[model samples]
Target: MTTHANKKTALVTGANKGIGKAIAAGLARDGFTVFLGARDSEKGHAAAAELKAEGDVRFVLLDVTDSASVQSAREAIESETDRLDVLVNNAGIASAPGSRFKEPAEEIAASMRIVYETNVFAVVAVTNAFMPLLLRSDAGRIVNVTSKRGSIGEEGAWVGRPNMTYSSSKTALNAITAHYARSLSATNIKVNGAAPGHVATDFNGFRGTRTPDKGAEVAIRLAQLGKDGPTGVVFEDDQQLAW
Candidate 1:
């Protein structure tokens, strides 16, 4: 095994493609030993191989929705490194047909529950599981991938009244970030939510205006924040977003 005792270590979940892949690439380029986590073994290894030219990148199979998978991922990473400097919770799902208001109540609940399983509860689960490794670092960073539509303070001007699926899941994620930051205030951990606005990805059928790299900019930046950087907040770029 290549020794990474002196390098910064990071993990990006759902990093087989899209913005998560971009963030993993960025971190690798920044000289961090990046673990690209994904549910698909083939794709995860492929992505890690593709990123090898950039820097040190490895694959970690992670299914955020399953506690066993989450535990296994944590163990896998822990075996390689004693500490984790950055963790980007970038796995999420888009809205389904039944997630809308006019849909049947049961359908809406099922859709929202699926979304929440990955978007909200999964975040908490992942963070809590890997938190020990994060705290081992001198400057721990947690970047929760959220959305602008999730902001309750701002009206959804662009995509008015986002359904209970994707948008509401992010709203819950933001609140979790706030509480997490508060809980870890005295520690080295800096927890924050990142809104990768309108990224063109398969998740949205390529309707977005921004590229995956552009959408990943905020999460990448947040992951590398210094000890003095802000926590318990949301940001898109340099601009802080409304909660």
Candidate 2:
């Protein structure tokens, strides 16, 4: 087994709060030098400081929706780290949980646009932008923090919920994972999606049954996959989730 690096670096996007924050803390506890990515510099620094008090952690200003911001983050990371061991796409938006899918065409379209901008487009942009840095590592892993609601099998469950916008965006993200896994099958990179189940997060007004710690479990596990571990798969709580 390869020894863990004393300065292994990982980045978790949208980590100012909720599942993303939990995941970043977990990685740091596991000995990674974490880069806590947040759109808000203030919150990002606060989170990094909280973890830095415990161990090594850095605050990175990253806005997945903005190409320039993503490029700048990539550049900063390149200058600071020799290689990126993990990239967790955990930042997302879920607006209007009670809005019905069939309520209005404009509403549905607007929701889709909002969710897709962060969940789908941002994941692709960050992953593609950081592929080179990941490839430089011996056992690079990419975990797309998705949800079971994204499963096509469960699409019926969200049909009337305008919140389906966030769920469907994740479905597309899973497709991107599969594509990237196939593209890198010959390489050492392992890319997969992790569903945190129904975690109690601000996104849903903290009504979810599971805690952020529980959700972070699968994400941290996926981030630490070995060279031979499975890829192009979706998991929830360490169990295979239906697609």
Candidate 3:
């Protein structure tokens, strides 16, 4: 395969479309060999083909909620490359009917399990599984795609928000980032969380104000962070977010 002295390898989960797809495209353009991970093979292959036409991009089958799928994806990567330079945990789900903040605990708990299964639980699983590959690199990066709604320090509490499932899931993800960063502090890897703000993506019915390209900006920046860059922090646009 084509290679370069400074070439990096990055994996972006849920990249079949929207903000995740944008981040994968941006990273590929930056000279990184990008693996576009998707749950659907058809959509994943199409996305990978589209980006491969522009640069070095490949398809990777990944289902955040499935342990077997995650293991297989990691094995495939190990077979192709010796190191993982970046890992973007962008896979998430928002369960309906009870996904709102005002939903009852019974409904909220159900939605919470689904949301956290993909957003929080999967993040930890993926990170722990790929960490060995990431450690193989000189400078490894991890960017957890979180949300502004997750900031407990500023948002007060998750109870009032109508978007409880999605919001609370992100809050748990932010905690995961901090915990992972602290655990890897002495190493070269830097882990951080990023909120895309209000991005116009299909997940939100494209109602957000910012474009998907704009939403992926900070995530890309955090992924390309140098050895001295900050870790265990939350960011959106260029500003550091609370909690």
What 10-residue stretch in candidate 1 is worst by lDDT?
Answer: 97-106
Task: Write one digit per residue (lDDT tens) for candidate 3, span 1-243.
Answer: 534547899999999998899999999989899999999999999999988765799999999889999999999988888899999998886664434444545454555677778888899899989999999889999999988888765553443455666777888888889999999999999999988878988788889999989999999999999878999999998899876
lDDT of 2 by residue, 1-243 (tens): 122455678999999899999999999899888888999999899988888765677888999999999999998888788789899999888753455444335565766687788989889899999989999988889999988778877442354454456667877988999999899999989999998988898887799999998889999999998777999999987688768
Best by TM-score: 1
Our tally of clashes for model 2 stands at 0
Candidate 2 residue pairs in clash (backbone atoms < 3 Å): none
Error of 2 at 40 (Å): 0.3
TM-scores of the candidates in the order shown: 0.94, 0.91, 0.93
Ranking 2 against 3 by TM-score, winner: 3
Q: Candidate 2, TM-score vs. the true structure?
A: 0.91
- Our model 3 lands, by Cα RMSD against the true structure, at 2.2
The candidate maximizing lDDT is 1
Across residues 1-243, which tens digit of lDDT does each residue of candidate 1 receive? 543678999999999999999999999999999999999999999999999998999999999999999999999999889999999999988765444454334345667778889998899999999999999999999999998888765554246643546677888889999999999999999999999888999988899999999999999999999888999999988899876
For each candidate in turn, give its C-alpha RMSD to the true structure in angstroms. Answer: 2.1, 3.5, 2.2
